[model samples]
Target: MPRKRACDSCHEKKISCDGGSPRCDWCNHRNLDCTYHRASASSRKRPQPAEFSLQDEIEQRLERLESLLQGLRRTDRGDPSPPAEISDKLPSKSQPPSHGGIFYGSLYFAGCHLGDISSRNGIPIFSDEGRRWVQDRTGEAAALEGGQELSDIDLDFAQNKLSDLALLGGHNSAPPLPTKATAQRCLDIFRASTLQVVFPVVDLSTFQEIIDRAYEETTESTRAMVCVLSFVSFLSLLEPQKTAELLPDVEMYATKAQQLLLLTMAEPTIEGLQAALLLCLYLDFSGQLQAASMLHSLASRSLFMLGGHLKPKPPSGATPDDARLRHLRTLFWLCYFCDKHISLRTGQPHAIADDQCDLALCDDYTGLDFIDLKMDGPSLAQYLPKPLQPSDLGLTIIKSKVFSLLFTPSALKKSDTEILHTVRMLDEELERWRMSVPPSVRPSLSSVSDPADPSLQHEFGMLLIFVRFEYLYLLSAIHRACGRCQAWSVDGGVPNAVRSSLLLSVEASRSTLIYLKVASEMVHRESFWLVIFYPLWASVTLFCNIIYKPSARHAQSDVELVSAVPSLLKKLRARVPTPSEALHLQRLEAFIAELIHLANKAIYKHRPENPTAQDKE
Candidate 1:
């Protein structure tokens, strides 16, 4: 008798089967899907590769059948089947983000989680007593307004996520807290190197006291303090060769610090905020982008919850320590600076809103020496302020406002008119900032030999370059946004609106490249990490134009602009200590090269002109 057809599943399993309609007996008995229907189809399509034997085809067919059966079995067992078209689309959740993706993802992750905390059972409470007092007063007001009061458990859980974690403690392999000597060493290193340069989140004297108190008696907060300093030590002090010796387990240290902070989260203090900031910066520099961003967001929320965002006026007839006030205020702005900086670059939403904050800009930081508090403190603006203020922190605050207004993700959702109006307002503010720069710190007035010339000098010039880099970056970002908004036309070809903005973007890009080229001469790894994304953004803009609109007004200029960026990146990369920087530059160079080749083909196809020879003639 002719062999009865069996399902693919039965055939692959080498089991006898009663070929039921649509399915076989063995598949049905096992509650598995039946592929016996495929047998007749497989027989009709007996075409095999000329090089493959019949056995090879049969083996391949069996293997494929087995795979299909396995998938069907999994589906029967409740596991979702993989997408049929997964080969065409990117595999989701199976691969890590690309390096560029990681960078931008880090920014997004940081922005989103800045204030994330569990609110179950009101377990986590605010760290600041002031916030608790405010909460009580608000609760009383609500009660007076006839609202029901929250239960104590609800209130405690509502406090913060840390309190929730503390209550729901689980064992984690966190590193041991440093001993007194170790903690003190880290504190001293942070105070000497990172404090003044990064922004002193807590006063040195106060942190010293915290450290001393830790030596006397250790607490969770003290342990967190030690961890924070340990991270800062890794960032600013520890020799690269000794990283293994010093930070044997960086992630463990970070986790321990986070846990300790959460455990004592109800009692928010300056030291806690300081520790959080250091840890965030360390995570950032260490390439733990997402973690850093999340931690930053958490610390920022804690600061806001603690009333750190609100500047408290000293009581009447009482002289408060303005130094302490200044330190706290500086910390708030530093947080704002970091949040806004990342948001602007990566097109993420900032953690805090503009209307939520009204604190003054960090005191004019110009001429502030490393050792003395004469020019760095809040009292300086009170006592020896300049008429045309030229301070790094002041510029950062101004840029933060611009970024909030224009560069955020929500900015794209606004109407064209609204975006243009905001851009104009930002442009006006930038111009105002330029005019406000004191001649001492201004790039124009200072002679080449002058000690203050940012271009010619090194020490002070580095800060000056930082300020300029930010200004140029924002300027380019604003115009670039305008270009994007105008780029699209109803006909799908390049429009007049886009063309003008594109040209403006190119000009701004050239100017930015020049600034980088100049800055690359004097500035090294220290400040490069802060503003590395600036040139990358500008280069990307130029590159996009070269590819999409190569036949537009400035094709030659665009090619030159794209070509120059890699050299500038190479210069910057030469001085950077991180291998990632070099890798990033190599990738950027490859991207630029690939795009330039495509752009050349596009230009040749569209215009069909020998413009190079014509220009040379």
Candidate 2:
């Protein structure tokens, strides 16, 4: 009377069955035998209470067996045997303790079971013998049972040597602070540089006072302040005017800054936050992206801890000119900007979630007016652009919105229609932001010749170049979603909307390369590090497009554009001060060269004139 249940094969596989007479859909598709065993009414009525108990017993036995197998495997591979005292306490292989787990701000063992692997407050509690065994394996002494806190564990054990090298700059001792006059000159140079225009993190007056105190009372100088000074000097040396004589000092300052980072990190303060962020930037500029990323996470957490993400509440009597409040707000926005940009560039989740922070832009973010101290032959202001009003911070806010609307995990899962709607909305927002920029620096969708006015170009040229690159980068990122959604339909007929997006993405990549070539002529050596990610991202986009549609009308041109990336990198490499600094560029150039070769090969294979051997046969 009732419909037959799923076939035995489907039931065993835990899949739905069509319950066909001869065979179920799954069984028929797989060409496997299908059978149904009808139960008698008496058999169905009988309860099977022991079934769950039997399953639990089997799982427990399997876990023990798996643990034994892991131990045996380790033994065969010549790893030391577990100590006698805790031999029976070893966890199942599937649930082995993680050595690098962080709980709250302290190190702890993760995935350790209570009875099998005893733990207190998420930190494993090991017997003395077990601790010794862990120490021997991990190369760091383990926490004592019950007596030691997670903080007592050596966190350095979790990090690899590469991280150590990045943090310490391969040096053992701190270098002496540069002479007071030299430090002052470097600081002056920093204020006039494009680095200040782009970042605006440091407060000059406050930092100057710190410098004076460091020199006056040398013993009392904070590690954080020293770290900041070293970084400032390091970045200043990277400016275009730097000579070969100063190259050694550049490396020395960077090394000194990095070596002090650990000491600075031990105590969290606003100065410490600033020092950490400067070090993060240094790491990024030096092409240690992974190290920079790791430091960024720590710096971001530090920002949150210091309440830098929130709008500062001045103590009841505090005035509008309160330097501390202004500094806090400035640092907060800087962190926000760095978080969004890094996430976009690295394809990692942003440390600052838009929903969690007050996204209001402050007027004080522009800080003090740039002063041209004529320490060198000519003031840097005579050559570099005056800082733009509204600054790059406005663009950063737009980037935040872009990441939230287009790139978030939930946003990626949207339907084609939803994605199209979001893309249009974002395009409108981006266009409005671009329009707000001063006409001289406003980025255009199409590639154009250099600005006609040399003065305006000199004043705002770098701004215009970077804005254009970012505009195209964002355009590609937004349209790439539509391109991906339509990629699956390439064999079928692609919708008109998706086809347009794919074309737009390719065009954006083309425009990026064109603009980069133009910008290379005007941009300084110091800014070369900034352009590395752009060309790589753009070239890869073009490479993918050519491969996807090798027979398209523009495919030939796209291949040529992809081919040009390596040369562009070579030209940009010359701008960097040292070979070590250009390592990322070298790697990127080689990778793009390979991509070009593959793309050319793909085009040749797909040409209508070319026939496969099978076609000839």
Candidate 3:
């Protein structure tokens, strides 16, 4: 009798099947529905021995490759090999063994998490519980020393201000535009302020033309343009004394711009993209960082959809004087600038990747020749501030490189040696970039001792101050990797590499605070956002340093600097009109206060006379 054929299912699955009636033995064993097709004479031809051997070889090779891959995976996970005796045993049905590793649920960038430094190295005094214990002891010590109790203001503010600001959920209606005179006043203020210089997203003449046209006719494009203008006006009023009486109007304009931008979000245009970028700036300034970050992403995506990331090529036969294309390029660079800075500030990935676009500056920025237009008696250059230069974009490009090389996900995964090498290379590159800046606007590591040059102060002071703060901030960020990679000696001796990195990081933090302190007035007047993150970041670094080594020579001064944070934050809070600004400031003030208290307690315990006092407590 001819051999019975296998069922189709078993044959397709490449498994042995007994030719049973209605159902094969393999299908019956598995309780599967089985059907068999009638075998044709040609299909019944058996494979030659050589073919069978080849098929067996292929299967064996695949199995070996799979086993090798599994072994590699296990090695990557640091899993030890099982004993040969139990190698073929099935995994137990019982609960799997615990890996004994702690998993972190939240995102952490270099130097962002205090726990990373404190928890590692077994420093109990720097831990959260240790800080709480110190707080209790400090309260008792304060009571014994007749120290005044914390004021009711601080206590009440801490209790009430703990809630996060509501960044979303607002009225959807667009607020009415400001009166013509008020609008013009805002436009003038925006032009005069350093905001235009810093962002440089809009062309002054074009912006004026759009505003004039909006008053004449209300089209969709004009409406979006109005939104952009509203945001500029709102930012101009951030200086407390300049628009104290119109503080309420500041919110109105901000709301109007925000609502208008939302309306235009569904149909993104270049104008709408501009509005979104401006709104992002406003949100960041108001301490709505997450909202700002989301808006930034939206703007960045819109920019890509509009092909703003690529070099702008005018249409066929179009004149070389493509002002629109130039504007788009300007907007692209502004987005790039904001993307890098926001990523650093929030410890998040940047929206714009450097490799995706051209880094070269536009012809308008590189070309020095500008035909002076006579605006009545004043030239156009005198009438409106100059746009950003190649130097400005060059610094931004360097900043992009810093984020790419130092803080990126891949960078974070680099080995200790690789991280150290990359940090050194970036430091040298950053130093080179700094040296190339003109002396008039060059930033230094030391605090500014003399007043800025009156000639360049108005136009370039904000840029200079930002560069200084950013330099220190980047320095701290770069060297902080060393802290993560440093291995503690069994003998408790500090390694030279660790010492150098610690000093550099701490010095950068100190310089940031001192620079801000000296330039506080200018920073507050020109850009409130500049003061927001740098001071807090620096204060945290100082706090960590003091906690890590309370007996260090600068411990006392670090405490003093941390103590001064509340005052500085208060001054910043006074400049912004948002109620949430006060709440945000209060929370930071509380944190700084706690840090100062803990730092002071740690220092007291470390004193020679009080060496045994900590033990007694």
Candidate 4:
């Protein structure tokens, strides 16, 4: 006779099965119900087998009844009631097979039918019903034969049920909210340590007012603000080894804050939107990109619905009031900044485009100067950077506009000449922006001499470093766009024009590397919130140039710039203690290591270790 076939599960998985009776080894190993189809003479075109022995016949009948009971218990629990009365369908042990021992075959057929019915009704074989079904069937099976099989069935049922029950309970429940005094402490920590650097959109006094008001009423918006405050406190705890002890409380507050955020997502308001953006920043810092993307999109939609992108209309007859406009304008620019930053990282189109937005630029806020107002009276000089200065806001808009101009669908169709022209216009405008930088904010060449030392010579704050850094990045972006399109020229290899464009890119990348070298050493460093991408990608571009244009005039400088990146990143990584920062640094370090190996093999093989030649052309 032909051997028995594998079980359905094994066949589906395309694996070999031992083809054991009642249960195959493959499914058994995985705690899955091993089922085998009884071969029929007609289907296989084979001769019928001789009659089974009396003992074999009795075992087969018991197995069939057990399978039937298992099927009944597999029905969907949501079916309003438990499985039908299966015990009534089983035959008694005292009764022997009637009709020449055909009873075993009949039981097997009934089991197959019940299993198919239960599966079609959307029931899982391993659910609660299956557990109860096994219990009932095992008792009945035990009466017929008490031995190894009965004990095995009972053991498997107990083990599986315990595992299932463990999954149903929330064993790792969250900690309770911080006490009022604890919350005040967390808030104080945030205000004293983080608010200035983080540039929280919520004003200090306004935030304190919200915290006080939050205790009075449990509004969704207020709760969201509380969560935001908690996250700010959490960020503050990320640095300084001494603060490590307080991290657990920070984590608890952060979790509670997220739970409250989810509750307020249904009915979003300006306060809620602000809170959501802050949460997005926190998530981005934590390397939770998927969650951050969702909140970023949410904040974008809420801002648009509130007409944040449009210029505010003045009262019909009243004096043109622009006091509150300053705050609203600040909110709008922050949203735009976030949209552009996320868009570049994700390669997704931004929600708000240059054409659709009519809001005033950050540069326009200079005359009004309402943003300079401090929490304690009019101490404008202290808040000079004013969370985000007019210049910084202008630079952010410039980056946003550049991204729009480069990534739009139609950009690919433009000719190389058109792209070059666009680059020229942007470069000229960028030059003007550089000239307009306040004398106090610009760093002297001497400031960057000792790459390891932080810059203390300048009175300017983080805003200056941010603007300078972004300017270099934008120049790199423009040239990168120009160089990418020059590939379609259909000319000789590495044409001078293409080489020149690529050279501009190398120079821009060099500046970016130098800025990062010094800026990474600043007292209040730029947040690693997507700001890290500029140096990371700029290094990649420089590496590609060293390999592809080894003969270019600036080849030595390019290699030097690329070689310095790993050390620069290490210094920067030492400043931030977050896991996300560490992960990014590890990957970047690996990338630079590979690039160095490749550079040694390709360019350094023929060149001297210390070449005196400089790129004069």
Top lDDT model = 3
lDDT of 2 at 532: 65
lDDT measured at residue 538 in model 1 versus the true structure, 0 to 100:
62
lDDT-superior candidate, 2 or 3? 3
lDDT of 1 by residue, 1-617 (tens): 34455555444322345778655665565455665344254356643212212123223423433443344344334223323332121112122222111212111110011111111110111122212222221221111110112335433433643464455355343335566666666655544442344455556656666766554533444554553544544454223333445555454555556666554445676666777877776655543344566778877887887677887665354344665666676677778777876565444567877678865643454433331322343322223332211235556666776666654445534433454456556655665666666654453211223333434453334556666667666666655555423213111223333334334545555566666655677754544445566676566556545434445566666666667766766565433333433333444456556545555554554453533211110
How much is 12 displaced in model 1, in angstroms? 60
Ten residues in a row with the worst lDDT in model 2? 103-112
Model 2 — TM-score against the truth? 0.65
Ranking of candidates on TM-score, top first: 3, 2, 4, 1
TM-score of each: 0.59, 0.65, 0.67, 0.61
Write the residue-wise lDDT of candidate 4 on 1-617 in tens digits: 34445565554332345778667775565555665453444466643312222233223423433443344235422232212332222222123322121111011111111110010111111222222222222211111110011134434644654564344333223324444554565566655543433344555555555666555534433454455554444454344343455444454455455555655556655566667777776666554454577777887787777777787765455432353454555667777777776665554567777788884654434411232212223233345444543236666667776766664545533444455455656666665665565443443222334544332333333445655566667766765665434222121122334344445555566777777766676634325545566676566567555544444455677667778877776555434444433443554466566655555444543243424211111
lDDT of 3: 0.56
Candidate 2 Cα misplacement greater than 4 A, ranges: 1-175, 216-219, 240-247, 313-321, 363-391, 451-456, 490-492, 575-583, 613-617
Better of 1 and 3 by TM-score: 3
- Give one digit per residue, the lDDT tens place, for model 3 in 1-617: 34445566444332345668677765575555676554544567743211112122223423433443344344334223333322222122122112222211111222222231111011111223223223433432211111112345535743543321123234332345666566566667667654565566666667765566555644545554546455555465454465455445555566556545666767767677878877877777666565677889999998988888999664565544476767777788888888877766655677898888887765556211221111123233343324663226666777777777766656655544455566666666777776766554566655345555331244444555676778788777766666543222111233444445656777788888877666766664435654567887787678766655566678898899878877775664444445444544555556666677778876886565763332210
